[model samples]
Target: MTEMLVPTELLTGIAEMDGQHDRLFQEMLQVKNALLAVSDDDAHGLALLSRLADDLVRHYAWEEAAARRYGVPFADHAREHARMAAFVQAKIDEIERGVCNIPALMVFMERKFESHVAHFDLQLGLALQAARAARDAA
Candidate 1:
């Protein structure tokens, strides 16, 4: 069994964001498992990768919206999101062309996501919590 990409310590404490993160990791794990299976057909893994990419786009948009709502500075975070999306797409393309190293790509993506959540997403989570508290206190 593959280890979880997002560990407990990396959780943002924001319900929706955490859920989305979990889903993204789960999808990626599924893709990894599919690819590692002893089968010639990689169609299922490819489809999962595509779906993961789409879900990541949606997650990024959700985070941006939350950042705006909570007055969190988002320019850097959005840029990071864009970069990650591009990287994932490029890797998917490489996989299609039979040029990708699946294990290395998975390791890289896991580390990248862990760092992003620990830094950017955690800051956004704090901001969101603060904003909600302020609103409730009014």
Candidate 2:
């Protein structure tokens, strides 16, 4: 069975972001399952990986846009997203080279992603909420 990539605690009280995160988590799970599968469909696994990578890129971009709209300083967060994108590309490269040992990569992504949500994303949520409150007060 594939492990759940998105934990329930990731809900930041931000509806759109929460939905996007849920979808990203599902996509990650699919990629993980494909990488871990013992089947001979290498092409399928690669395709899944490609799709997951693309989804991740889009997800990050969406989050960055949200951060900007919320008046959150997004430099560090965007940089981290870039780093994660590089990491994903590297993992995809490894897979393409027939090195599908993804247990460590999976662990890294899980830990880093969870941490990002707890810190960066949570900060964005708070900032956005505060902005909304300020607007309402004004």
What's each prediction's TM-score?
0.93, 0.87
- Runs in model 2 deviating more than 4 A are 1-5
Best by TM-score: 1
**Best by the lDDT measure:** 1
Question: Candidate 1, residues 30-117: lDDT per residue as tens digits?
Answer: 8888877888998998998899999999999999999888787899999999999999999999999999998789878878988999
Across 1-138, the per-residue lDDT of candidate 2 in tens digits comes to 645345777777777777777777776677777767888776776788788789889989988887777677999989988998898899889878878577677767767878888878877877878887897999
Those runs of model 1 whose alpha carbons end farther than 4 Å from true positions after fitting are 1-5
Screening candidate 2 with a backbone cut-off below 3 angstroms (N, C-alpha, C), the clashing residue pairs are none
In model 1, the worst 10-residue window by lDDT is 1-10
TM-score of candidate 2 against the unseen true structure: 0.87
